[model samples]
Target: MIAPELLSGLPSTEELPCSDDTPVDNEDQNSLPNLLLFMLASLWAERMDWYFGVDMAIYHTTGEDPRIPVVPDAFLSLGVERRKGGRSRRSYATWEENGVVPTLVLEMVSHKPGGEYGAKQEIYRQLGVLYYVIYNPEFWQRDRHQPFEVYRLVDGQYQQVFSTAEADHPYWFPEVGLGLGFRQQRLGGIEQEILVWYDAQGNPYPTPDEVQLQLRQRQQELDAERQRAESERQRAESERQRAESERQRAESERQRAEQLAQYLRSLGFDPDQLPEQ
Candidate 1:
């Protein structure tokens, strides 16, 4: 619990800077979080009770210096605003956000080492983050860990919840109702390995662009089916019209033959005695 005095002394989010003026490890480090945010916006398009931060400072009073903050590569908080009170958040202060800490945090390791497996892990544990993920795409061998790792807080400790058998995709988190997994997907017109969100059935949640593509493909299929049905209907109608025309022609020929026979009888000649034409 935070002391009342400490809470009072904590700076307002607007008064603090949004970021710490440090650069991300690489483009992937910067884009991964944003990609997740975009995907969530489409997945939960109606809900406004969540906030996902990319490289944002999370100021908590738990540490020695309340002014200092631990900035995760990405962080997610439930029961928070899509925007802070319908306004952009300058920084995430636990006290300001109704004492809500991040439920999930992610860290991506790069060429230059960040302590994702060391100090940062401990910090997230102490902050009571329910889940911590470390994505070491480039330097996993050096760290002696897999490219993707997920740890769940259990009994006041983080337990690694991944095995070699499930290395491609990890277990689902019921709290968030999403799963973290690695798959090769196209982003920004490039196909590469990416960390993606999955559902309970182990289906990856598509990006906004992918969703659009899917909708378009479905529409095209529907249109094709409609066209096929119409073509079949037209074929049936043509066959019916041909049959009707044939019947009318046969009736006209019979009428003409009866008229000729009547004329032959009037002339005192039997039409049935004539040669077949």
Candidate 2:
């Protein structure tokens, strides 16, 4: 906890640089984090006590200088306003936010290693971040690390908390009430691997596009059902009209026969006797 007296002297978030302005070596550095941010937004649309930042600066008093921010690929902070002061935050300053540090930090390893395993891990450990995730999809062999790894702060140190087993693909974080995992998906007509959020039961939450597709499929099914019912109703109506027409024809024939019999009786000839001819 930063002392109130010292906190007052620290620079505000507005005055701090949002990030180091380092260009990402690969597209995943920017795209992947934004994907996670978008997923979180959809998952926690109603919640107002969380914030997810991508390539954002996090200023803290734990470091030598509060001005030197640790810009993670992505970070999630709980117990903080979704929007600070009814507006978007310029940067996440621990002192301004009641000294609440990020709960989790994500670092995506690119072509060039960005110290994800050494320096940055130590930084997150010092900041008391509970979870640290390192995703090294393409260059894991070079770094001698797994493609995906999750570390939990245990006794002031980060310990590996995930395995490479298929059954344990999605590592659940009970503290955050969400799980992190990877799956292959097609995005923008390109098939690639992507991170996904999971429930405790290991059910992956559908993307916005998937949800919309499901809705459209359901509507089409309902329309088909309605059409089938209308066709059955029309067939029944046609059958009833045909039966009515047959009944009218029989009645007319009976009336005509009775009229012919009456005329024969009026002519003084027995119709029953003439019917044999």
**Cα lDDT tens digits for candidate 1, 1-277:** 5667767667888788787777985899988888888888888889998999999998887788757888888998999888887898888988988888888999999888878898889888888899998888778889899888889999989999873324457568889988887777787789977777888888888877688889999999999999999999999999999999999999999999899899999999987787777
How far is 173's C-alpha from truth in model 2 (Å)?
Answer: 0.4
For candidate 1, the per-residue lDDT at 177 reads 87
The alpha-carbon deviation from the true structure for residue 240 of candidate 2, after best TM-score superposition, in angstroms, is: 3.9
lDDT value for candidate 2?
0.89
Off by over 4 Å in 2: 165-168, 247-277
Q: For residues 228-248, could you state the per-residue lDDT of candidate 2 as single tens digits? A: 999999999999999999999
Evaluated with TM-score, which candidate comes out highest? 2
